[model samples]
Target: MCGRYATTRSSGTLSQLFEAYDDTDGRHRPDWNVAPTKPVPVVRVDDAGERALSLARWGLLPPWATSPSAGARMINARSETVATSRAYAGPFARRRCLVPADGWYEWARTDGGKQPYFLTRADGDVLALAGIWSVWRGPDGPWLTCSVLTTAATGALAGVHERMPVLLPPTRWEPWLAPTGDPSALLGADEEWLAGLEIRPVGAAVGNVRNSGPELTARVPDVPAPRRAREDPRSTAEMPLF
Candidate 1:
């Protein structure tokens, strides 16, 4: 599961990258360790069909939820069952969004314990993670929240964990955010696209959300894997989406 990640790009840059109008109102800041329940930037089309970049709580809160605390456990929805899950069906049908991130963190289970690894595009391109959003109204007002969709890890990613966030390529971005788009067709991880990614071993500093900065993503000394060996795709450039 993608429990932590990094998003240091400014709102202006994100607005330009996604070609969406900024709706964040200048409240977002660079975060290296993004945790659940925290506000995250999401790109989605409004009711008028105009794409907009806005902030939503990282955890999704279904309309039936009685309190905000329920969101913490709903941080990620399994892509295989998102369209049928009681808590995700509605949002998966109409509230699809793109979650922009520089990269995401995953922990590999090892004999010593769990070792952290950072995954990102070798070209340094931003990742548009597939996500679904919801709006829950309380006595105060309407609260916007979202959850990232995770699919079975494919290719080299499986060596790190059994699951990884569903990354949408540029060609599928519009369709992914479209209300009528078929989600299942775009749920799998493309191996050609996956070939462009580089998985680097990083320090344990990222284990603590309180620690922030570029240091958290800096590559550390390589260690022999107790699990499956991680493949290096540095020679492979990112290819077009299939």
Candidate 2:
């Protein structure tokens, strides 16, 4: 459910951080409000089994899709069923990738309106979101695409939303992007890692994709409306795996 996020790093910077060669060909630009259908940077193993930083459309288009528009709804793949889902099974087994983001935006319902919150690493490190990709051969040429993976939100995130992107730690990044492995083993939320995230209430400017900049991530005063009660933490364990 990570519909909007920020990734302002250059391809070169990401290449160095992820230890992947830059294959984006300098087409990448800083994006503070990435939306569906936009191109995004993804780190994956190339044909030679070496990691490469490449640009992929935000949504995933299965090889058999007739229209590129189908990608909109395919922006996120639920971790629990990705291995068996028709549109994701193949990519889950062979085309796993790491989606680097500065942070993600989640909206919490309030009496007045929806309040947007920005969740990022407390240490200011980038988040390597779990992802799967596919190469769709269209009439023009091959279209590279990808989808973020989501799981039941745990720890502090559950209060904001029942689901969140599968954020991978550095220790699990290699296992996730490896050619093969039981992805399910790595889908669970790591409490230690989750505790490192800082959730800041930010202005609603982020809700509009057209607005982009450091200001979008700046903290703002909480709405005066009654804040929703913290969702029962115990309910997290029973939440359906996304």
Candidate 3:
């Protein structure tokens, strides 16, 4: 599960990268530790059938949900049941979106303890994490929310975790946004295509959301995992979404 990640690109850069117009209220400040329930940038096809960059609440709230708080638990949708889950079936079929991230954090259980690792593309390109969105209506207005989809971890990533976020390649981006009946074909074995990715050890500072800046992502040598950051219950990046 992808509970935390980073997105530091500017709106202008993202617009050019996706070839989509920007319709977000404003650019999100660069964050090294993004947590659930926070607003994040997303690219999706609007009602006019045009791709647009917008801000969406990270937690997904289905229309049938009674309250917005329900969103907190819906941060991620498992790929195996995404097409049929009661809370995700509708959005998965018609409201697909792309979650842009510079990289994501995963904890690797080592002999010392669970160590945090940062995973990103070796080429330093943005990752389009496959996601689904929803618009929940309320008296005040509409609330835009979304959830990242996670599939069985494969190839290199499988060694660290059992599941990882579904990453859509550039050539398959448009095909995924189609409002077709079923898109299982797009989820077919994609491990070999992700060989360009690189994973490395990063400082435990990333475990605390309050601890920001480049220091959080700096590569560090192997050492004992610090206890403070990992023990902080509010630390977003260190939280296990599973």
User: In model 3, which runs have C-alpha deviations exceeding 4 angstroms?
Assistant: 223-242
* lDDT of candidate 1 over 1-242, digit per residue (tens): 98999998999999999999999999999999999999999999998999999999999999889999999999999998998999999999999999999999988765667888889887899999999999999889998899999987766677777788999989889989988958789886677777888887788999998998999988877554526433433222343111
Candidate 1 lDDT (Cα, 0 to 1): 0.87
For 1-242, candidate 3 gives per-residue lDDT tens digits of 88889888887788889988998767567788888898899999999999999989999998888888999999999989998999999999999999999889888766677788777887789999999999998678899999999997765566566678999888778888877746777876465457767766787788887776767667777554434334434323322222
TM-score of each: 0.92, 0.93, 0.89
C-alpha positional error of residue 224 in candidate 1 after TM-score superposition, expressed in Å: 2.3
* Candidates 2 and 3 compared by TM-score, better number: 2
lDDT (Cα, tens digit) per residue for candidate 2, span 147-178: 99999777557767778999999999999988
Query: Which candidate leads the pack in TM-score?
Result: 2
By TM-score, how accurate is candidate 2? 0.93
Residue 178 local lDDT, model 1: 87
* Model 2 lDDT at residue 188: 84
Cα deviation of 118 in candidate 2 (Å)?
Answer: 0.5
Model 2 residue 64 distance off true place after TM-score fit, in angstroms: 0.6
